[model samples]
Target chain A: MTKIAKTSPESVRTVACIGAGVIGGGWVAHFLGRGYQVVAWDPAPDAEQKLRSLVDSAWPALERLGLAEGASKDNLTVAPTLAEAVAGADFVQESAPERLDLKADLLAEIDAALPEGVVVGSSTSGYSMSEMQVKAADPSRLVVGHPFNPPYLVPLVEVVGGEKSEQWAVDWASEFYRLAGKSVITMDQELPGFIGNRIQEAAWREALHMVAEGEATVAQIDQAMTDGPGLRWAFHGPCTTFHLAGGEGGMAHMLDHFGPSLKAPWTRLEAPELTTELRDRMVEQTDEVVDGRSTAELIAQRDRRMIAIMRALEEVEREEAAERGEGQA
Target chain B: MTKIAKTSPESVRTVACIGAGVIGGGWVAHFLGRGYQVVAWDPAPDAEQKLRSLVDSAWPALERLGLAEGASKDNLTVAPTLAEAVAGADFVQESAPERLDLKADLLAEIDAALPEGVVVGSSTSGYSMSEMQVKAADPSRLVVGHPFNPPYLVPLVEVVGGEKSEQWAVDWASEFYRLAGKSVITMDQELPGFIGNRIQEAAWREALHMVAEGEATVAQIDQAMTDGPGLRWAFHGPCTTFHLAGGEGGMAHMLDHFGPSLKAPWTRLEAPELTTELRDRMVEQTDEVVDGRSTAELIAQRDRRMIAIMRALEEVEREEAAERGEGQA
Candidate 1:
């Protein structure tokens, strides 16, 4: 295993996970994999069993990536209440239902129980950090640490600060997430969907428009992205990929080549108000594409492929390092 | 290797590639890999050597994918001129410069040289197919068959038809590309960047705006995508991923959770017009993130990762097939 930077066993001894849903379960797996004892709370019956099952299924890929650390399943504990989950915890991750009222109420409860200086992070997809931290005792200690689903595999965690959020809190959260093997991006200010969701929404908006307009089927549009820009964007980002599209001259050439078309009214900025017909179409199309695959099977397949990609990247990095050494010699 | 649907070799025995640049060379490699004789033309003095080197480097990967079809290097021939390249060709793929006038002249030349019933496809990124085919001998035969870079690896090919293009021509072209191990998406009309580039451009526009607004650095923004949605998106499209984002309810739940945020003016529809300052910042930031990785190295890394991912998907498919068979028994 590559030595994780700036992390120590003592730095994050106990982590609290509030809400043991799909996202929360993923967080638990990630924290446990990184050698932290996880304390989780969820009012739902069978939450523990569900989370355990997810963690068990996720372990092999995590182990392959050196993500599983010095802990076993026995190290994870289920807290009967929120306070119990957070007591003596170094960090708390909240993945409650997305209602602001529910989140605010939970924050108040959690704030009263949290030890001073402990960082509280939210797994919010669209809620503002300012709103979520309104009821916190020390709002400065609360930060929005929005992670992509299946956090054990996906590396992104968008770290944002509320109006009262302290710089140290953001830095500490960022550092902690990095220690947990996540790629952290600190936002200047909290925005809807942070960065990833907004981009996703824009693309979705256009795709929905195409489908609505009868220009293409859901399958065709999906294939175009997966087989084309999605593949490129997976490795090189949209900006860099476009810069390459411009050929040797880079973005300048690209802009010159395709700039005029940017003004075209083809982009349906108006969000497709999801009519029942559209919704049914989407569900039907998705079913067709993913037929015969259960959610568990799809997730497992996704995890394995993610592991393979990460391993390939590691191999590339190793080769580059060797080449650099040879050049130096 | 999965059993590929056989395409009769007689239908596309000889492929004529005009302008043996990067894209054209990719076509040459793809066709030759699929057991088609490829005749190519380029004005550059060393075009033949360059194409040869590209094909040689690409061959091993093609062989691994069962795409090389046991063809020799000599299967790809460089003709002295456009006329010579198109002579006796079954299908002609024009990858000449993106300039409209250049394409106009080249298409006319190709149309005049190729025998009757030969399908002519353009590798134009966004030029209208109707406009490009305006001067062709039989404009109905012209179609846009744009493939993403490293075409042999990436499966997406956008097939758009000219105003005069026949349904049979489009279907034939689609089948031919699929036979060469590509996934085809048909476009109703030729719009700028077609489906993939336009969607990508939307994301890039926002990324640039964020950078210009000082919301995040280029590296941070790039990391956000690579570590976040980019990872999941490799397995599923944006819409599908977002549908999963809604948790159990799918797109409806996702929309309800995030739909309100669509009205927020977070993304700059007009990205500060990509000023010189922004351009320099973009280039510098991209360099930092890429850290001196050569284009060839990046391409190889991309190819390696893609192959690994496809193999993993294949495994999942096989397992599912086995399970279905067992259930039936």
Candidate 2:
């Protein structure tokens, strides 16, 4: 297999963020923090100010995590139009709303002005790359590089390619993300929610079922994840955690011990389809749980913790690297 | 309704850690860090040294999170016997090997020496409090307080009651954990894996099914959590995330939109019973995925990230508290 050359942020001097919403601002923060000049476009009248504020607020966290290596507000500029945003850009990230029509229209406009080698990606949560690339003039250049929210802090970015997306595009995008300090997972095929969302959806489905059946309360279900697998999943991921659950036998042992339980009809897997009643119950329950916590407060809390986690990880990585270096010496 | 006095750590002067294994060592670190004198008991000749090393390693991470307030080796004493360990203890935490008979036998010894008013809690992951207390002189004194691995870092501690466990025991244990800066979720009754473990089991069961069916690789399954819900879950619990998923419709909208998908045949809720073949596959896949990472290495990584997250949460809490204080002024 031929190794594809990765794009370093330094090498990609210019980038564009299309549809400067919450996620788009994250893209700007991430790109600008890594030292790439960003040209962002959003039709919203307050888009520029919103993006600026978001980027500015995220900077301290970015700097704390060493993500602000080459960042400065001067490196970011708001383009009046989408065509102008894609002009001279090596990378373009679309954070448009999740409507398929809106995405297709935006991508078509983007494709018309996109540089020959520019890799255009979307931050769409549920849309497949195949669907998004269908309307693109050069669909081969499109990739699905969906990132978790507050992207500058969360390391995960799912990299997927459409049928029209070239292998090189996937490889190149993966490398670009790696250089930008994001953990990249390249999907073999595009699936709804890709890998992360699917798993989350699965878990969420089961949790909702539990609530629908009155077997567990909303707080009980949430507590189960946070106090249990949530803690482990944040660091190790589900596969590894289950692997550990297997004990000395690994996943096999875990399966042998608890496999019988999985067949229990009690799973409530058929959770009464989320009726309006259930939805109201869930909202009321959640509001009661979060109480008056604002989005800003939540975001700040999230960023502070994420930085701390990243720093600790960096320390561990450094120590491991030093040990490896010592061993080699 | 008479207000129950909130359980606080102020009254907990001594904590006896029964069975000085990894989990027990974690208990010692948390108790001592929170200013309680920790008395540990184990039959191993090097129990003292092992406990000391674990405590020492835990201190830096704990200190980083502002959790290691009064931590000191001098505050930790290794007892020659279980009886000696609980002589003056205000709380007894048993982390003995997961053998029912062994636990039963040990509890009898521990119960004989526990000071009056002290809460006796087991760290058993799935065992019922009734089972552990079956051998106790006063079963009402026993409670199930299961902490996630490396209890010193992960804040969740599931406080469950058996048929015999008194309300006061649960309340006192909850308060003690809160004072130690742990998040406490009380289960009204005993269930296998309590709250966190059972939900995790549900997810894991499905994850195993996915792997067995070859729907995804170990890495893919793991990524699904880390990159997707895992990221959201690190900050907000599952219920809140779903509530957000509902968007404007909140949980009700989310249920309405995604509820139909719940009944899909693709839902892995009907997991195959853990046949021997499936178990082997799980083990083989996990080993292949994990490569050769040691438990300690994996745990250290987990601890490092957890500390970072907790520290971040603490900062947010501090900020919120400061804001509230200023508003009052």
Candidate 3:
């Protein structure tokens, strides 16, 4: 069972993004900003226009982050069909709707048309890659390259493989993602919701319980983070933060001190019954916070803020890297 | 019962910070930056020197964040004793050690020395204010003003009252904290960790379970957040983020779609057994990530990066305020 080694991501100049909705279109914009000639396709009739608009909306942020040489909107081409989109592509990302059947069919179709060793990554947030790879002829090269929202701005990409996936494919995808300016987490085992979503879901569940019990408002919960732990998380992970909390003793001391409180009723692990009352309260609270802006407006504000944060981190990161004399590439 | 109406926080010109550890020292620096005359005292022999050095290290970041018209290091006075620290102070912030007995005795001591109607706020991260207020002669004026690490940079200070604490005291403390440049959450009722610490503890417990079970490394777990959901958290909290995930339907659709997964085996609500094996693994992994940097070095890096993130958020916040003519005052 010999394996086909993958190409160096730096050597791959053209990329393909299939099913260009919000997630796919974000990938298209991100790739284009990195100077990759992007071939995009979606079955929807208005897909081309929507994708182009998203690219345009995202460009200013990319420019602020500093675009790669030769990067432009002109570099993105909308193909009429999937085969044409992946015909000569070096990498393909499938971001179809979350229907498991739809994703299985879409991934298999991309696999059939693509050349060997050209990895096909999925943008599905929660689906297991093994389930999506079942219908593919060459499932060995399929990998999950899950990203957070506004993929063009956020640098994280969770890279993992299916049961049928080859180790080399996962390795290649992780390396490619890093070269593409993403913070890559390569997971050794498959877990429901992966790593990031799982941690997020736990916190989300607890937050809902808080709202259901009428302990806090949606606004207060948001403030608790953006003004508190979230600031620490920007530079360090939760583990690191807690380790810092341990003072000089590190995680060991922290666990011994705060370990008993973990079992206290600080959190409700069970799902809170989201009754109609809770639902309306959530909607109304969010509406009050939104204060007459559309979802698009909220998203645009988020993007603008996200860009500022990334640039701030980059300012220090670039300096630290220069001092170390290590080329980022 | 009739309430004693609190005075306006803008009238506060002097602040007393007792027991000057990191959190206490941070309060001193933050108050000084807001242009208040700061009087601080600590029992440790080197406390004055350590406190002064901390304020000096943080001064540059606070300067970048912009200081009040009269803000200066020259305004700080390290008192010879706790009684002197609170003498003639317009407000008091107590940041003694986390021990309940020590805090109870200390709060009572401060209460006896404080003038009528002046509020005294504690900096305990997890203890209930009521527990700490038990021994105080004037418990009505005691409130919890829990803050995250490096309080000079992070703006959140969870303010809440104990069973004996007066409403006016909590209100006065909250408003005073806001005027002092802290984002204040005045909780209605006392819970174990207040809102921010409760939410953070839930995530921390789940993360520890992952590490204990050998499902993920300490570094990988941290990576999962800093790269993924942590990005969204900087702008929005968990509830708002899940609402965004629901597409146009908001939290209702999100609850309906992903609510069932809340009960899945994704989290270990009970504390994981922190046996020596688990403890050693955590320590070693953290050391590797620290990469020979002393804890002091790690903390310095965190402080520098934290200042960068806060400044980034402030840039947009200031802009949005100007557009709305709020003046950020």
Candidate 4:
């Protein structure tokens, strides 16, 4: 049987973040902003300096979102090694590169080093927890805690257990993520790409198809989303948006009305090949849009816009709750 | 050669709206709110009352968005016949049901009734203008002005001419839609579903697959979006988003890094069969999430949320422009 963490999810104080790149650094920023001590380690030669730089860049956005009590950049530590990082942590988050062998070796190393019953959550966007846990000693405690990019700002964290994972560990990770101020969706089974990625990948593939076929330019595709469905998606998901579109009939009417059209060859079902021509076209078009702006500048722009949208959503939810004569949701 | 409208698109005054269901009524409301006299017609007996009700319901949202000068719901008139509706209009928008034969016949009727060169925009979600313009007398003047649901709120309008459609007509319709306060995307070719729907239909198909396979509930899929990519999408579209996700590397790096994973079977490529059982499950699950809220209530809620997000995006754009020492974008 797998052991459970002794510390309750709400009481977790120190978190170990392994392999601090973009996702890991974002996690460091998030944990530090939430008033927890974060110990981070990465194998890159200048990882400590780069991680600090990433955190420093993310600090202003976190401040705008309102930091937790006692949250400070000083609370973060650059551990000398992976073992040192996980030795005293109540929880561990591994954000290594997406290579399967590297991820498995890292998880096993962390498993061997961590105290018994400590939960380990991996920030893998693709691989299933089951695939990564095969090499770990305490595979039962490892869970997938997939998050969107810039995890410090995006609120969603999908929590799911592997085939060897214990339900208690899954529940523990889910609770811990929620307690860390995240909107979490816990899934029972291991599905490839999970929920968000599956839907998003489909959309992305469609965009690629359009660009490949010259049906629309990159700017036009992006504009189509931001101006149209993307706005609705900010508040409502695809299903609910369609439900509202049905007017008086709701989902039943929506399915009955548009279901047959689903068979129409509107969307290119197969993924487009990333041929050299396609790749060059995409890169060139994207460069045109980026248009001399540095990635750092784009990141800053993206973070600001995300914060504004999130605040707007929060306000909407609060108003709706108030209208319902209830407290904040 | 087809004659061009005597009145420039910038000077279009009275507008004709054919078919007064959800899409048509939304158009009526949008035109009226934009301070244009609106003539509407639908063959159904209760068309006038329903159209009026829909316009009335959408009015609050338009008011919140700041209606144009002299905008008034009282300016809308429901004509007794289709000919009357199109007789004196400078522009016509046909929002009939999605049957190709019905649409072609209706466009032909509208073409015969209207002035020689007034551009006609079809709000058909599925059929392209090429198919709908087949029987029309002035096919050159017919174009697709596909708007997302609730055209009064969502700013995206995709404009494209049919195979026989003149470039001049497409340009005029695109410019006119932009003038009417929409973010317009002018497509050179008519791909199935145009820009927004193609991308959106891809995402929606993935959702249906998840529900049909029992991988996720309706609520979970929706939550994944609202809390994740949907938020990012409010400001940046999918292509730019992945570019941002590439960190210091930008899109060139992103395509190189994650482009290979496009082949991963993360998304179910094929659309699910909409069997009776799947339909029942979808309706039942949606009902559970909706929790007995009337469609009108849902629409009101959706509108409030969309307005809030759009305003938030506008604020971000304004701040960015100010930072750049430029006028508002």
Candidate 5:
């Protein structure tokens, strides 16, 4: 095996996106908006049109966030085939459907076709990179670079590598995501659901239990978070929030106060049986909350709101940066 | 028993904030910033000066958010005693220490001194209104109006009534909080720890479990959240974020896909025993994250970031309100 050095994040200009559904299309838009030449491919016949539409819809919001120098939708090229998409690309992002065998095959194909040492990433939400890397030829360079929905706007991207993956590739992906204006979490190991989804799934399951038990309506639960801890979550995680809640003692004092309550029968991590009755109640309650908005309409609304938050956070960061520079001067 | 009519939220001009710790001082700053005359009381001899200092420290950020008409620190008055604070108050907010006995005695004193039908809300994070109301002469008006830290910035206020609480008093408190620009979750029943704290406690326990197992560091866990799902959490609760993640099919599809993985035992809701070793590690890791910054500095940073997020959210809300008004027109 020839030793390979990892690609520099800034040196990579042309990026490839495979599978152009919501996640993939969002990636395409994000890359294009950041001044990367994005070549994308999807098996769906209408994927090109849909990808373009996703990019178009995201453009106005991206424009507000300020695009990278020379960044334009004209930088995107929708390839007709997977191989064509990755043929001359410096990096590849596979956002295929969530089937294990399908992802394994897709990653293997991209691995076989890619140039030596050119790393490839999967935008998988739950699949561990180890499971998907089993079939890849250059498994050492394949990493999981999981991103949240509307990836063009949300700053988070969980980057990790499988057992077969080399450290440099993971580092490359982390740096690349950061360079692309993302807040990246590079995991030391291939934790299931990475880190984000596990916490989310835990909380989501508890929420389902609450709904199933009629402890709270869907609307009330949403309000409980949005108007409560969710606000703090925007800037700090649960641990840090607890640290702050600890007053001057920090996390130690927090544990002493609430440690016993953690054992109380307040939250159940087990998935509630999704009975038809429960399902109907949730759907009805959610429909009531959402008020007859189509999925597309809801998605648009989410994207718009996400943009506002991202822009606001960005402005704060920029202002803080300027202030720090002034202080240093 | 005669039923009390709810006090008009708009009629509230003077508010009383009892206690002058961080939470109480925050409430005083919030009330004054909202253009209400705030009369505050605390038993500590230095409380008056401390309360004034807190309000002064918080004033600049509040000013950036744009003060309510006539809002000023001059509106805050440090009352000589608890009774004097509530003497001419339109509403009373109790943010006494978290000890139940102290709060019980304090609430009873306030109830004895308050004008008839004036609602008194306690900012208790752990105790239910029912527990705290046990000592009050008029328990009906002693509802829980729990706000997050730095109550002046976070919009969430969990309002719940005790068993003896009058429906009209709860309604009056809810309307008053909303009028003052707070998001109110009028919980139907007093569940232990209320809703937000339970969820937070659950997640906090799991985070401790990970820390004990050496799965991640304090910084890693925090980054895993703030740079990962924490962003979405700002706008959507866990359920909605998962629903959005399930593609066009919604929550039902999401439940079917990821529900079982939840039971894989990644998270332990039962509290992990906080060993001295674990506690030390947490303190040290947190110290590294805090990086020699004083607690006061960390709080200032948190407050600044929170104000930025709040202002941004306010902007989005203002635009949406305008859009809705146009639609109605």
Candidate 6:
């Protein structure tokens, strides 16, 4: 393994984003909005123009979100070569296409070009860092820093290390993302699709089944979500929401009451048997999630946030309607 | 069959709510907040007190959302008997326990007492209305009007007809829900778990698998959603969100690009066969969702709404923190 370069998360000022497509361009916008100097590289002939336009379009949203001090769109540069992009970079984020061969080769190239100790984060939504790190000589510094769509707006960045990755590298990337105003979920081990994608994929597949069987329309599925569970999920997750559904009884009561229904054909996916051990763990973990807050308190907090979210959505709809009216006039 | 109730959706002055637990009590709160007199009945002795307290707790959130004209908690009454509750009632909503026998019996009882032509809606989350209406004499009037938790706040109320239900009843329930300031999704046919719960259940089951296998914690799962897809789902559903992820090409390009990964073991759930028919349907339906708007316009709308949502969340957090600090003092 090659000797790694030394750098601290706080000392990083320059970010090199390889593969300036949607996700890569998003990272450019996110970093730039945070007042960082962003250097991007992509092999596509018109990549520069597309990247610049993406940044320009995302600027107003970032401005409304309150850009970091000294943040500006002009702080971006599209490099002609990958090596030149990472030559003076303090950190690297690679968002190449999902083809494993292409990702491995590009990761290896980035590893060879990036400075000795600077951590390299791959924005692979599904691939584990272990799979991508296989071709790199210094895989110790590589970690998966998967982000959701429109990384500039969404705050989640799931971080995890490969088998060969150093725990410190994973920790550093997590801390760096947190410092950059992103909510980070750091995993101890690699899991297929990680946490978010696995849950999302399950729901997505079920939706596909509905459409395939002609059981529901795509518009109905979308409407069902935005109007129902999606409203609660804006501030709460499925687990906590269920806990609240149990009323004062909490998750334990919820499991006991609804455990039998798990066998019901709610979705195409069969649930794991609610064994004693699984039941205990879920009940325990959910209690830990409750974290000393009473069910009533949690419900109150949820209501407050949900009410605020609805108001915000209403305001947005009003603004859009007003803008449309103005355009029509 | 007993002659049906004769009240129209417009003349629904008083709503009879049977089985006053969480969902039933929520219906009570919802109707009361919409300026309707609500008479509630439950077998449990303490249900009246519990229902009142729930309404009291939910009132503040409803107030924040702006109560309808003349809406008040004083509009509610705790009826001693099921017959008393539905006497002269213009509409009946049954929120009994999820037991099929109990629901069928309750529906029959409500049907026997309700005025002619008045529609009776069951708040059954999973059981199809067909099964519940099996024992009712006037099954044509029974429809499912399932609402999410805390019915007073969340706007979604899914309306669907049973095999025996009249299309007019389904349409009336849907219209009534809309008139009450609730978002309504009317379904043409019965499907197990309806739409929202199926999608939610699929995700929930996947989450249970993770916790069952020790792959992730409950907190991590919740965090993954709240920080990731949950933000987007507040305004956009999974399909539209995927459509946006396709960049300029929209859902068609997305299906072509990521369709292969459907076979990946992202979740234990098996995806449906992505035949050409399904593909064309999804593409066409998603295009319908998009209507005449360009991908760029949709992205900009998504960004504006997301930014507003984030700001709303931040503000709520600050208020909660301040309250906690005040409590400490």
Q: What is the interface RMSD of each candidate, in Å?
A: 12.7, 12.6, 13.0, 12.7, 13.1, 0.8
What tens-digit string does per-residue lDDT give for candidate 6 at B7-87?
667778999999888888989999999999999999997898888899999999889988889999999998888889999
List candidate 2 stretches off by more than 4 Å. Answer: A1-11, A41-88, A101-117, A135-137, A206-235, A238-329, B1-11, B32-88, B100-117, B131-137, B202-234, B240-329
1 or 5: which has the higher TM-score?
A: 5
Q: Once all C-alphas are superposed, what RMSD does model 4 give against the true structure?
A: 14.3
In model 1, state the lDDT of residue A34. Answer: 82
Q: Is candidate 2 or candidate 6 better by TM-score?
A: 6
True lDDT of residue A246, candidate 3: 57
Q: What is the alpha-carbon lDDT for the whole of candidate 3?
A: 0.76
- In terms of lDDT, the poorest run of 10 residues in model 1 chain B is B1-10
Query: What would the per-residue lDDT of candidate 6 be over residues A1-329, giving only the tens digit for each residue?
Result: 54444677877889999998999999999999999999999999999999999999999999999999999998998888999999989889999999889998999999998878888999997688888899998899999999998989899999999999998889889988998889999998899999999988998999999999888888999988888888888788989998888777888998998899998888999989999898889889999989988988998999999889888988888888888785321
DockQ rank order = 6, 4, 3, 5, 2, 1
lDDT of 5 at A177: 87
Worst 10 residues of 5 chain B by lDDT: B278-287
Point out the worst 10-residue segment of candidate 2 chain A by lDDT.
A1-10
Q: What is the DockQ of candidate 6?
A: 0.86
Question: So what's the TM-score on candidate 1?
Answer: 0.77
Name the lDDT value of residue A184 in candidate 4: 96
Instruction: Pull out the clashing pairs in model 4.
Output: none
Each candidate structure's TM-score, on Cα atoms with residue i matched to residue i, is 0.77, 0.67, 0.79, 0.83, 0.79, 0.97
Compute the lDDT of residue A235 as modeled in candidate 6. Answer: 83
Model 2: lDDT of residue A15: 80
Poorest lDDT segment (10 consecutive residues) of candidate 6 chain B: B1-10
The Cα error of candidate 5 at residue A119, in Å, is 0.9
lDDT of 6 at B4: 40
Best by lDDT: 6
Could you give candidate 3's per-residue lDDT for residues A1-329 as a string of tens digits?
Answer: 22675467778888899989978998999999989899999999999999998898778667766798999999999998899999989999888988899999989899898977898889987688998899998999899999876687777788899999999889988988888888898989887777777788667666655655557666677789877887667645787666555555445555566555556666755323333443333334333433565533443344345446756766767766877797562
lDDT of 4 by residue, B1-329 (tens): 46667579889999999999989998999999999999999999999998998888778667766699999999999999999999999999999988999999999999999888799999988888988899977799999999987788778999999999999899999999999998999998888889898899889888777765668777788889988889778756787676556555555556656666877888966433333443333334333444565543543453355446656866888988988899767
Q: Would you list the clashing residue pairs of candidate 5?
A: none
Query: Mind giving the per-residue lDDT tens digits that candidate 5 earns over B1-329?
Result: 23564357898999999988989998998899899999999999899998898788778657755689999999988888788889899899999887889888899999898888789899997687877889777788889998877787777888889899988888899999999988888888877766776666556555555555446556666667766666566645665555555554445455556445545555553223333443333333333333454433432343344345545655666776677785321
Alpha-carbon runs more than 4 Å astray in model 6: A1-5, A326-329, B1-5, B326-329
